[model samples]
Target: MSNSDFKGQIVVYSIVGCPFCMRAKQTLRDLELPFLDINLDSYGESVRKEVRERSGRSTVPQIFFNSKHVGGYDDLKALLADKVGLDRLIEEVKNNESPPEAPKVPDSSELKKEKIGDMDFTCELDEHAVLIRDLKMSGIIKDHRKGLTTHKNTFQANQFVDWLVKEKSFDDRATGIVSGQDLLDRGYAAAVKATRDGRFEDNDTLYRLLEHDQNSALNAGLTSECEARPASDLGEDLRKLILSLYNDFLTPDGKSVNYKGIAESSQFKMYTRMTAQLYRVDIKSATREEKIAFFINIYNALVIHGYVAVGAPTNLWQRYKFFNYVSYIIGGQLYSLNDIENGVLRANRKPIGSLSKPFSKSDLRLVVALDQPEPLIHFALVCGAKSCPPIKTYSGKDVMNELKLAAEAFLEGSDGCQVNADKKEVKCSQIFKWYREDFGKNDKDVAVFISNHMGPGEKKTSFLQVISQKDYKVSYMKYNWAINSQ
Candidate 1:
């Protein structure tokens, strides 16, 4: 429509992070049309239902120009393509007259497939109850007493939808909504409210399984202390939890882990409960051993936890963002994966290729940064990838030895180190290549470092012979970025 056709505001209901929504908004901006874009992602089911009812469609980017349905992005584009039609519609709106009804445009293919048949919730209530119990075991159900909503032993509607999508093979949020409504309708679950508003929401409305009493359940071997514990005790308890989780779910070779099993384990529940206590952990008073053991354990645990909560990063850009964004609150301060790795463990240095330091001069987490970077940590920190060192638990009391063992064990592996004596070449894990400065200043220093850490083996004998020659080249093996899943 012409700019003057819209005397009133145009309204577009959209979902946040949807590319189509972004394109629709950009189209309106280019046409110089005034529009209000309401992000449905931020709102509750009440607003979502209003959009669906008003537009007669569940899909987003639902456009309405002064009370006339303009369909979706495709319809808007088509309408704008016909300038005369747009101008006429605008004139009708300006004259306070209804415009002629236009033919409805078919919706974009983003629509999820409708379930083929109706499910009998009454007959399947027991099955759903078991599913709810699984969610509790998986740590999905918890106390969500944040901000104004003082919910207890409950899970958010959005979280339930996510669980259904991931664990139950529900194709989309629409199907999840259907299944959630069935749960409510069948009395398997209920909203934590006296007055219910909608069928099922993909928002922050709290839900509780009617069959289970999470509040009375025993702790899954975790300390019941939700408050702060001494830094030393915290590190030791975390170490045990990490070890237990690894033992239960790690692959035989320790090169991979059963992340899916971990996600559903009671140990994961314990870890989630334990993280709430991290906010009060006194990092400033932590001894060097405590800090090293705590942060390393925290980092490795967080990588697995993040993978369970959110899917693993699938590409380089996602890996970059994942490392930077996924984080935890410790001592009332935020520590991202990068912050814990480069800031706390690496003494506030920047990550490889990153220009800025992990912690700013004024950052509170700087207090937790080590006095000096520990190069041995390069071998201990597991990033949930195959090329990473095998996952292991470390004790603060013997962390120095544990780290040295980790380094030696890594060097003994084919992935970590290989020597080609005849060709006068030595290849090492990309860990050394990525953090070269941490290991040593020169190639020979790095080669010598490798030689020093290499365990007694045929490879070590060959590597040392090459190192003694002092003319061998050092290169990095191609690092594997695959998720180390068992």
Candidate 2:
């Protein structure tokens, strides 16, 4: 009934691997409402049946505002039509409201135990097997022996081999503990499988192997040999593997794979793995600029990887095309581009390209070279187009900071974006357009805010200035999304 009455109350019933669920979560976050999430995918059949009986929907994204059935995605959107639905729901919850209780699912541990052997091995095996198969299928692996090794981290090297054996159960190279070449082949295979299935877990495991190996090498006092393991040892093969995987997963016409699904599932794991690897780097061994350069390579690589995977156009001029999609992934998740840039790539006081260039896209680093403060780098990345810097992939360590910076920068930078005053028209950024809950008191607040941003000069102005100005019109600007070209 009152705003104060609904300070923090929201509940979302969702399923993992479901895009709708992710969308719903993003919606709630944009609204700034604290809500609990019930992941049905992790639940048992009995619980799912119970939920179905109560909600009368077998599909996921069953949301409750206060204690009422808010239905699925469409239903949620309907509630959002008035824009006050989220606010009202929060109020209702604060008033001690209870939505009709959906059946509760068991915890993850219980589910994991129950589903361990029952899992569709075909799916699991297919997901895993495909990694190796794709490498062979793509003809990327030249040698079954010698396996690739970036460093002398034997633990990671062993893990890489183990992952291959576990996934493929390939016995030929499984004996004698295999060489770096053999492990390299398996690693590439695993990566390919991950891309094909859109399974981040697999990719995460691979990254973990790299991190573990790096650590093992360091702990063994084998830094020289490990560090000298030549980029050629893994770079060329890795590049090819990543390229192929990206194409298979994201490209629509190539393989008809579900790029979006795979991206969502695997991105979280990828972020985690990458974070570990970056953090594990011997910063003392490498200069600050060198670290930033490494991150730049990773950032650009991921952008290219994501773009290819999504089957989006890759020309430099088409940067705006993928802004919304890129922003959604970066901003909606626990990890983001800014996390990598500021948290791990900490090359402040120096430009991004002041160091060496590992990748061909050396020119792209200039976009991040703007005079804006280090704190503003997140905003710069958010605005980064194909012509701009690649969106840095984030890790768990920097998630909170990344989210905060992204929200603030996006809001502030949006002030300079397209807005029309006269017709009470405002074509603000799609972020405001889509996740209106994130900005306004409801949706109306977003319009008012955009109107203020549209005002000229740096003076305190009234709502009248926003509404009455002749030039005030929201222009629908095309988002640039082309791959960064050097």
Candidate 3:
């Protein structure tokens, strides 16, 4: 059928946690066009079969402008680039020339409720126990001997919501309240007084961890201190944990990170617990290589954690907020993503667009800052974005070599560095432009650094020749901020 034969309907077949699907829907929203979103994940195989039969695609985010297939995200983007053509298609849809056939499956909202109803949230009882245990250990939820009434140990609902927002980075108090109710409903926590008709509140209503044989003794409120582990031991465990996560969810090439799977894994729950132990870890005694490896791993893992928990930042202001807001409490000091990259990794350098260094001379966290900057970390740290470098776990024993290899891999790619032999010009990733000071003082210096880091190849030969002749222009490639999903 011709494109005009289909009109007056827009359908998007998608799945939960798919970034491209979210982008497609967001684009529709921005255009002020109403579309029926169909979540394949919420439907049966028959529905998927129907979608495949109609759209001829098995992947998520199959879109149809009217009954005419618009393909996937990239296709939609290309169509959008042709404004006149897109406007014509939109006008046809608006005119309702011929109403297209509606899918037999329920829309996303109905399917969302159905899916939630199908979930056995009680299965997460043990996981929620781990979460509460760590929250108490971290002193976020103050378990007390005598609170509200003469109950043994209790925490307030407001305190729980605060932890969810400030520490866990839940979007708002409402979500935190809902999660709190889920904890209660799942039997991980119980109402101390059955207040508020059994609904979790954002007020000072009291609750207590449900006594389990596993942690009953630890709930006595006497041991409020975190269980101490040697910094070296914790660091090793952290490294292993990262490797396990990468092995299970990250692709071998590191191009795709299964963030949705990572978020749901038992390993991630362990990671959440381990962050509590970071409060007392002795970072000061670690060797330089140990510190580098530790912070690099932390930075990479935290980026994934932030995206899974808070979502990928969409704009420049949101990016600044994200880097500054998502943080960890290590060695009794709060270290933001920016702090780890700039303060610890970059030797307390000023962050992008910042007039001052991340840490002041008098700041306690300054003690953890490197004496000199390591420029190669820019390649090692993955920012959970498409344009960022590949994810890799590092060991302290071989971190320097690992960093070198990461830099080499990055520069070898067109996104990182591309040599146009005919034009005598070098095009580099915006990473070099953003952290230019780290690479060098000027364009020539940055070009030389890129050339040096590149692995031995014809591209390297061409770049080196260009540098030798001092006849090359350096330009930066536009950065893509899309989430790097599997």
Candidate-wise lDDT, in order = 0.68, 0.39, 0.69
Report the lDDT of model 3 for residue 21: 66
Candidate 3 per-residue lDDT over residues 51-90, each given as its tens digit: 7667654445788766678877768879989999898878
Q: Between 1 and 2, whose lDDT is larger?
A: 1
How many clashing pairs per prediction, in order?
Answer: 0, 38, 0
Q: Tens digits of per-residue lDDT for model 2 on 73-181?
A: 6677677777576656656677674544533335555463422112211111222233433333432222222246432212233444554566546574445144334
- Backbone clash pairs for candidate 1 read none
Put the candidates in TM-score order, highest first: 3, 1, 2
Model 3, CA-based lDDT: 0.69
Error at 450, model 3, angstroms: 1.6
Best by TM-score: 3
Best by lDDT: 3
